[model samples]
Target chain A: MTEFIPPGTRFHALPSPFPCKRGGALHGARVAYETWGALDADAGNAILIVTGLSPDAHAAANEANPAPGWWEAMIGPGKPIDTDRWFVVCVNSLGSCKGSTGPASINPASGELYRLDFPELSIEDGARAAVDVVRALGVEQLACVIGNSMGGMTALAVLLLHPGIARSHINISGSAQALPFSIAIRSLQREAIRLDPRWNGGHYDNEAYPESGMRMARKLGVITYRSALEWDGRFGRVRLDSDQADDDPFGLEFQVESYLEGHARRFVRFFDPNCYLYLSRSMDWFDLAEYGDGDVLAGLASIRVDKALAIGANTDILFPVQQQQQVADGLRAGGADARFIGLESPQGHDAFLVDFERFGPAVRGFLDEL
Target chain B: MTEFIPPGTRFHALPSPFPCKRGGALHGARVAYETWGALDADAGNAILIVTGLSPDAHAAANEANPAPGWWEAMIGPGKPIDTDRWFVVCVNSLGSCKGSTGPASINPASGELYRLDFPELSIEDGARAAVDVVRALGVEQLACVIGNSMGGMTALAVLLLHPGIARSHINISGSAQALPFSIAIRSLQREAIRLDPRWNGGHYDNEAYPESGMRMARKLGVITYRSALEWDGRFGRVRLDSDQADDDPFGLEFQVESYLEGHARRFVRFFDPNCYLYLSRSMDWFDLAEYGDGDVLAGLASIRVDKALAIGANTDILFPVQQQQQVADGLRAGGADARFIGLESPQGHDAFLVDFERFGPAVRGFLDEL
Candidate 1:
């Protein structure tokens, strides 16, 4: 029997043969998730929150920890998400490393880590996994569903693949299809991990982590997540204090180098290299039009949600504001009351995470209306 | 006794003990150079051209190799540079591998490849080496000095360090100093090279090249050199035909991936990783403010050139058009005849090389006036 743990919650296993989008099946797969507030008697007040590539399921704070969550500022009683009014469910992505069913998880048949043997994943798979968790909890219909970055793509997939799962939707910093520039960037990142000698063809021992490759890949990712405009204003051309006895040309001289290093180092502590490889590829392969017989508007039409909100950062090159506008336009054309909000930000694709002041109010307004 | 090669000719060595900007000098250092057209009476019509990080001394087609040069379409008889009217000389930058004294060159003292032992190079060192070559050829004064990308930075340094060597300057797609974003990108690239176990601290045998690392770095470089606008227009979300028997997430699915792979492969065939490291760092270390004791305008004032031209591409994120405008403004404020021209392009930082039609006209107009 699954224990009903309070907020800062633990995970529960999904039934066997979890269907994946591409082909292979996941046996006895599980999803790690967290929750806040109480589910209504009718089980109609649940809000499912999906996350980006790196964030965990800890989207909001709980009484057990009380220290604050990743989105604590905007997810409290009076905040945009309003935990007092709505039961928020945040799921750790299926292909992620945070206690989720991923390449790092043990395979039931072989009794060993799946590694590269893990089924090829897609955004649709992630969305379906979240829906499975929701249904397992005896929820007939969700009040709303929200997603950011990778989550945004998954949320759209969930609505398209399983219609009427939620009454409303919120997609943030995501695209209808992966742009070539983004695909190229992610491809280089995978190459960085795979080229590392220690990767060992995805069979590396736990002790022999692909540290250098993972760090390099994370560094590149950080560069893309944020904007050059922000870096210029923050670090500029200022030199950092160094300990080198002689001038090392390749040494960390600029403050920006130090900033990138700090971020990359922090990421390597939690993220798995193989999981990064798999999840990044899944995001690159995502295309909403695939579900509608190569017609994006048709796919949008398939989403039966009553309302939708599409939020974008003007400076986001990964998922440009234009793509977000397309999401809003597509949904509106498909008979859903959709609203698009383009926020001016120097934070680029990361603005949704960093600029909660502007984001929170917009989200609150959208949710209150629903 | 030096060989007197004709116009459209081959290389000649710069004298030994090539003086560098910071501390120790390069021993037995030599520069490879190519020329077009005849040096006129009094040698007053010579034009010096400096290239970017990758290009060699072969800026235009010559008698030796009838095949066109990298900039052949823009540097011939009736082209922007007009070889028939002015003697044009293109030198391989110091610390570059193409027929120049670089990490790939043998060290006179150790009798082995200099590799990392190659002294930390600076843009000023590149300028000085080019000046030495010009002096060796009996040229008293250059009619103009032209630089593109890395060359542009070197051209500025030449004017600041050796004020009266050239009468005019054309700075294209280059910056007065490295921006934070660029520094971060370059730092990650260097990490990619260092992280490769095959690099062996720059001591790897020729046969055991760090091919994967170099290819990864080049791929990242290619992505940054071009813009997302161009990639979106060219490749979009079209999938390339793949031979994978089963669904592989890491498969080459996008045409953009193929394009990047092709470019990376071609670059790895010619570029030395160590040389790339040195030159990339040299660019990061460059700052015009240092020349004038921390005053950029003061440094610009030190350039005793008759006139200057600063051309920037609209889509260039590496060295932005705003930075180029600053260059023009600084020169004009410093009592020099300076003009700034912003060209619309989807090619980004590479516009100077790829969109020669737009670039050629601007350069020709600037040179014709001078």
Candidate 2:
């Protein structure tokens, strides 16, 4: 038996009216979200966990379908998130595949999948949708908003774009502006997808999916998500199999290669190719300073959040410790209660997911202070 | 004016009997090399400079073709290599394109280019070719054998394989064994070449070459050659052209991508795809312990080098600082006067090429002791 939402549980769909950059007037674009636990009569004690690039409202608790939520370990009873003490809400991000108005979602007018006709989505747009989800849940304000990776970036965006949405924010292993190296890497990944023969300019319905392209993209990502020293220490010169001779061409020659291949294969099965492109482009276009007249501190000043915790991993070359320092400095200059934690973890940018023993305690401490 | 190597300078084609791993034998497979300055009466002033994977015997002196030698800055008149005093010799290794017996060389049996039929060449074979070059120069012992990257690995191999060939060794960012991550990255580069439709199983003729695959390989190599931090700092989110908006479909969007593309394009023109594959494979197969019952120290014990300098760069993730430490540790354990120097440079593995101000002093200081 699995846990289920009570029959009387309230769900809301709040639509927005904003003209997209691609000349599409998006009307009645409602966000779908689910709330767990009780919101105090004063609409306080609410915690919002923003979902990642492709996840949905089912990001905390495992439902009757029983698919493990992305953050199942952190959100359940006695977990760091502790839904019993606070009302937790998560929404399907804009331009996502899972029940969101993405490329795969059907258009109301034509009754056809939006496909390549979808509007370009920005981080601001995604954050706006998240705000709508909270407002529709009858919550005037959130105690805190926490997110990881891209979701972390979105949490920062929520603070900047939506006034007084959250009292505090937790940004884990993310940056306000995507770095140039990241943009370059993501450009190559996008090229891989666009170069695929089956892509046909993102209109491949009856043909095979761009799997080879997706695999290449995932391989590039694996290189960024972990430290070279970690890879060398864990798998230096190690063969995939002990029994195979050096001359065997088809055998698993290197352990790191085998690990990358496994990750690439799994990512291809679960991820959408077009969504990957859109989200990568969104990340590249994100520059908070640019929006605030090239002053990052001014952008932080615009955010109404009372406090912030900027967390980074020492080995995370993708989102380095320096970037976290920049965020903390900017927030402090803006008179916000900002602190930074540079954790020593060899798992690189993915440390937030792997080093939960340390991360869970840090999150609990931050939330306890609130 | 650039000084040139005068025509009619005496050169030697030293062909040694090298044993191949896959049975059979190759005789008179000469290593072509050039020498500058005078070998002392006792032939004790000889300094051997081992070239990296793609470079040839023209390591210092300018050629008639107007293209500068790869190490011209370091090996010329008053430079670190100092051809004015030290008798500097550089050889085209066993499996190379310039006047060496590589895949393009003629096969003895069929009198045709070996091509795909070429034997798998190991780092040991490359070192043996260098040894043959040294012997042919009439020098009984080398004052020093200096190398960078793959060439550094070859220098280590020489010390282990032929003890009396060199009295001192300088390894610039080298590793005794290729890490699994390195092998995996190199394997993908090789596969990028092999999977190209134009590769034709390495049988592509002179007219038709795998330009796309070679470009991809170079693109991948460029990423490893430079640090992500450097890339971001130098070309952060800057568009190649200001006129192009964020939504532009064609042309490079970021400056880093353009830089990588430029590097890849230039590399394809001067470098052979087949040679890149063979050399990377040679690097992947480099493991000193494989020759001495799986004991790396035991293998290096045969080397009679008096002093060894293992140098590394701070930002070099490809051949990192720890790798240089491994070289120093191995040589020290083998009773050699080993010293480790970790240079702080932001140029990544290519720091040895660009950071000549620091590299010059380090090299001169090490050689001054001799």
Candidate 3:
């Protein structure tokens, strides 16, 4: 369960002795990526797409791997990303278990899972790795860089740390910094995994996985991913039929509870707990304010781009709509034509993933002009 | 850690074979309560206070116990409850581990902890037990019955099931029925506990207690008790000193994380895990809609009361302000002069407990006229 690499995934060998931002280095390290369409001779129509915590490099169905990808609806020939016109490259985050060099990956020197031996991961580190993938693909400058959720933070870092990497940017449900409420949620999720007896200090194997802890963490994440209004409209007070005569009095009673159980079980079975821990902590540690003399806006302003569009759902609580507004303002302060769009979708932080009607047109409009 | 009873707590032995609403009966069960001030002749000046999932019967310092109670600020000689004018009784919830008959209490027949053997507890059961204690105190009818958090649910149940039990009512941060969002949150809390291996199907002793599980549950509760606004104002991403050079990369980094850990550790040591599960489930199971054809407003309208006051903070996410407005509206539909007051306190669900400046006057303003 440590790594879940999809077929047809390509790899970029990072420079030998790749140094981590917080310290430590890895030898013979590599990052996974996948691209759709051919890069133009001038490499002016290339776009790099970074993702949230879980997704692999395979974002959309491709000829090499016909299976529908995580964002199949949003990333196809005629989809929002429009592979027919633009060469789109998606990199699996460096700290993710999805075919990336992370805590779940085997250390080349020791031939053992990095696990606790992995250096502390930060959003900046993943940003650097994504840049390496883009450069190796022979693209000196990307037409646009699109990032969502955690990827949004990494994309901003990519632009801030390595200026002129992309001509334009699209941030969906992103933030300039992690807020207290979000930190609390992520901190609790990490504790759930760490406290599980089966975690055993990150030594659990596939047969005896930290299923319970992972389930709890994923359940919490799912709850926050959507808005309460959506929950009320979808589940309401509907009771599960199984709740009527269940022997375990504390078992699932509502349809919502059953939904969470099903969703969590499906996710935790494939995702590695140690990798999840490393990535979750990295997000909590990410604050753009560090680059701005203790000001988030200044940090955001430091990232330069020719044009940008920041879109978010009004119902997003984890990365609230206000943060997107801030992202636009900060980039605009840096002289970029950063337009902000707050969609009236009830999907909360995950609106960009499901509410394509609003996000698609906004992303398409921004890229079409370029 | 099964039960933590404060000294000087008094008990009222229930009628043999006291029945529970869900099913089963207690052979020689009793409820714990503590009174402040003296009961006036005819018991016309009596007031009963029902609390949330936690808290003991001692609502304020009394002659028998000089120590401060959880609601020490809100109830005293010159305070909102004003013990000098009205005799106050606070009953520890029946399903609680605090000096009351619950999963932690020993069964009369088997002389073993009730644990899972305890009948399914509903809000109606705790309401019935509170009413019995009120009757035993020589109060034919209470002048006012105040309920806060879970207590608010019990208070409404008291008025609904036992029609003349109390003349007036006050519901603070309570709900008419459990919302899907709240249910999801509680469901995760319960799963965190049940997943702990040390819980051992509810058979673990104090030495093998589910401390990790309890810690997780308490931390989740603490996060929701206050609002994001308050967290931002109070902690604001402030880091703890210990987090600076901590060897554990996943350990506490923010002040908010430290606050939760310290708060959770203190609570898990005293609160019994089984009692927590029972009480938490009871709150989720309660729905006044059961009395009114699946319509929460109709269910609330069935309750009879002379006067009422519903108070809540605008920031409350667990029990949002809209629920209080509904309580007021439903009680008004039943012909009671129910006044709804939404306070501008950042404390959220726990505003009634901490923001005394706003709540004290609201409670006193309603009571002084009565």
Q: Which candidate should be chosen as best, given lDDT against the real structure? A: 3
Better candidate by DockQ, 2 or 3? 3
lDDT of 2 by residue, B96-151 (tens): 76666777666777787676666788888888778877877788899999988899
Per-residue lDDT of model 1, residues A1-370, tens digit only: 0111235556868778987878899998888888888899999899999999977787777865576678888787988999889988889999888867888888897998888889999888889899888887878688998999989899998888777899999999987878898999999999888877888789776588788888888998889889988988999888887662226556677788888878987877578788889899999989888867897766676678889999988888788888888888888877889989999888999998888877888999998987
Q: Give the per-residue lDDT digits (tens) of candidate 1, residues B231-348.
A: 8899988877766222544757789988898898788757888888989999998889887788766677667788889998988878888777877877777777999999998999
Q: Against the true structure, what is model 1's DockQ?
A: 0.84
Q: Looking at candidate 3, what is the lDDT of residue A188? A: 97
B1: Cα error in model 3, Å: 5.0
TM-score (C-alpha) between model 1 and the true structure: 0.94
Q: What is the C-alpha RMSD of each candidate to the true structure, in Å?
A: 3.5, 4.5, 1.7
Q: What DockQ do the predictions score, one after another?
A: 0.84, 0.48, 0.83
State the interface C-alpha RMSD of candidate 1: 0.8
lDDT computed for candidate 3? 0.90
Question: Which candidate do you rate higher for DockQ, 1 or 3?
Answer: 1
| Candidate 1 ranges with C-alpha deviation above 4 Å | A1-7, A243-249, B1-9, B243-249
Q: Which is the winner by TM-score between candidate 2 and candidate 3?
A: 3
